[model samples]
Target chain A: MINVLVGSTVLPGNLEAVLEIYRELVARTRNEPGCVSYELLQLREDPCDLMLLECWLSQEHLDAHTRTPHFVEAIAQLEMLETAAPALIYTKSV
Target chain B: MINVLVGSTVLPGNLEAVLEIYRELVARTRNEPGCVSYELLQLREDPCDLMLLECWLSQEHLDAHTRTPHFVEAIAQLEMLETAAPALIYTKSV
Candidate 1:
């Protein structure tokens, strides 16, 4: 599996909006052919933070997902935050 | 500021062992002078997947944390995982 993990720190009040965007991202991602898993995680103590994870069968699917309209829009929204452009890492399964 | 994010897929049966170890990490991290925040988040859909997020006041603090005994212990434990050596990225706040 190829795992893409992203963490973004949002303005305290913008978390809800940010998550709403992710919900769309996840919903669409689940229908993609190589998507193994998609999840959104929140800090129990700090609700303002969010972690987004997407596991794919291959890098091809991940690249496709990034090209979608939802991702384009999502990337655009990054500028709306106090801090965005999440830390992204790709993990290759052992 | 510096953010270090790591995510690992634990063997279904080994999630407990992994998290128990992380508890020690978080406990010690909170006491470190430049540790701004530390959180362990699990995927709601895939509980075996874990994401570790650590925000430090600077890269200096992160380097110091890595030199500590607990982190060395954590590094050792990573070798125990079915999948380890998480994809690490250092994010600079923009």
Candidate 2:
């Protein structure tokens, strides 16, 4: 499986906006083929910090996700509200 | 629920040792009370980078886990093999 940890820092006043996008993105992404899990987490220590824990069946599935309409739209919106580019760590089970 | 993302970088030549430590840690931690999930992930881009994805019922449960013998011992051994202190991000579902 392909596990992805996506860490993003929201802009000072854009938390709500970012979350709105995620609500849509996550809901849609979860229904995609090969999606095992797609969860959103907000940091307790730093409210601006958000993380997406995603699991996919394979690299092809993950690649397809990136090109999907929901992903493209959500990412564009997220980029505007985020402090900088999100940090993505692609991983596999140890 | 309390979710934790722990990022650790292993020292060169210590991957096997670190993995050994985690094998014990993950197995023991899974049997602990209030442990919803405990998984280890290794970065695809950087083999030395590892991440722990954990979920618990509450902060109290997580605190208890830190005080457990298995946790303490495993952490001690991990520190010796890791390049630096792990980065812990405590979180809650958004």
Candidate 3:
């Protein structure tokens, strides 16, 4: 499986709302084919900093996930909430 | 539990040595009092890029881990192998 971490910094006042959106998105994402695990984590030092740890069967599976309606919708909302673009890192199991 | 992702870029030609060091460190760290999980993951696109996903019972537990002899030794070696200082992000479980 492929491991991916997507990091984003949410605007100060938008964390709760953005978190709700992520909750919905993660719920939907877990049901997609090839999804092994998906979780949203909030930084303790800066609660507005968020990270999503995702495990998928393959790069293709991940690409497909990005194309889904849930992803598209979530990304649109997340873009508005984000202070900057997300940082995505893809890794393989050791 | 506290979730921490520590990201680092290894100096080229140092990946194998660093990975071995990490393997040993993870083995030792897993036995630490508050360590829930400690794993090393390498970026698929850039093998020299590494990330360590760590789970600890509390910030105090994490701080203690940092002071351990094994940690001190491993970190010293890691510093020499790293292209830059590691980026550490601590988050709470959602």
Candidate 4:
């Protein structure tokens, strides 16, 4: 499987906003072709952080998704996030 | 957070082979910059499946890693895997 993970720290009072973003991301990915699973997870012990798993059939499909206009727009909107550390990764297992 | 997940089906008699691949992948990635957490996870209920979480700093960092020779070399070795389904993803949560 190919996996994509995006993580962010939630602002003190922005839990609702964080949830909204997560819900939207999940809904958007679930119907995509080759999407085996899309999971939005919060660290059980770390209320301030969240992680998402995007599982797809191949690197090519994933790359295509990342380049879509929707994804580009999402990034633009999230640029104002108040978190300290944010990350995105693309990886394949050995 | 940046998350990279990789998943695969384990071959019927290749348990040791699978473990060796995981060990090496973990060792090679653990020290990389912006790598906050690298986990090799075998599904609790699915003996034939495995998942890995490669949490890193940013999209740029992840993209660079994907372009590295090691990742390419790893791919060549795994091309012979006997799994029915293999997948990859690149995603950013909204």
Per-model TM-score on C-alpha atoms: 0.51, 0.92, 0.87, 0.48
- Across A3-46, the per-residue lDDT of candidate 1 in tens digits comes to 66666678877866777777787788789889987766664446
Residue pairs that clash (backbone atoms under 3 angstroms), model 3 = none
Q: Could you give the interface RMSD of candidate 2 in angstroms?
A: 2.1
Task: Look at candidate 4 and tell me the lDDT of residue A81.
Answer: 63
DockQ per candidate, 2 decimals: 0.05, 0.65, 0.54, 0.06
Score chain B of candidate 4 by TM-score. 0.76
CA deviation > 4 Å runs, candidate 3: A84-87, B84-87
Which of the two candidates, 2 or 3, achieves a greater lDDT against the reference?
A: 2
CAPRI tier of model 3: medium
Candidate 4, Cα interface RMSD: 11.1
Best by DockQ: 2
In the order shown, the candidates' Cα RMSDs to the true structure are: 11.7, 1.7, 2.1, 14.1
lDDT of 3: 0.82
For each candidate, report what fraction of the true interface contacts it reproduces.
Answer: 0.00, 0.66, 0.50, 0.04
Q: Write the per-residue lDDT of candidate 2 for residues A2-89, one digit (tens) a residue.
A: 7887877887688888888889999999999999999888888787888888899998999999999999998888777885444555
What TM-score does prediction 1 earn? 0.51
Provide a comma-separated list of chain B TM-scores, one per candidate.
Answer: 0.87, 0.90, 0.89, 0.76
True contacts kept of 3: 0.50
Model 2: per-residue Cα lDDT at residue B2:
79
TM-score winner between candidates 2 and 3 = 2
Q: Write the per-residue lDDT of candidate 3 for residues A1-94, one digit (tens) a residue.
A: 7888887788878888898888899899999999998888887778887788888999899999999999999888888887544455566544
Model 4 lDDT on a 0 to 1 scale = 0.63
Quality of model 2 by C-alpha lDDT: 0.84
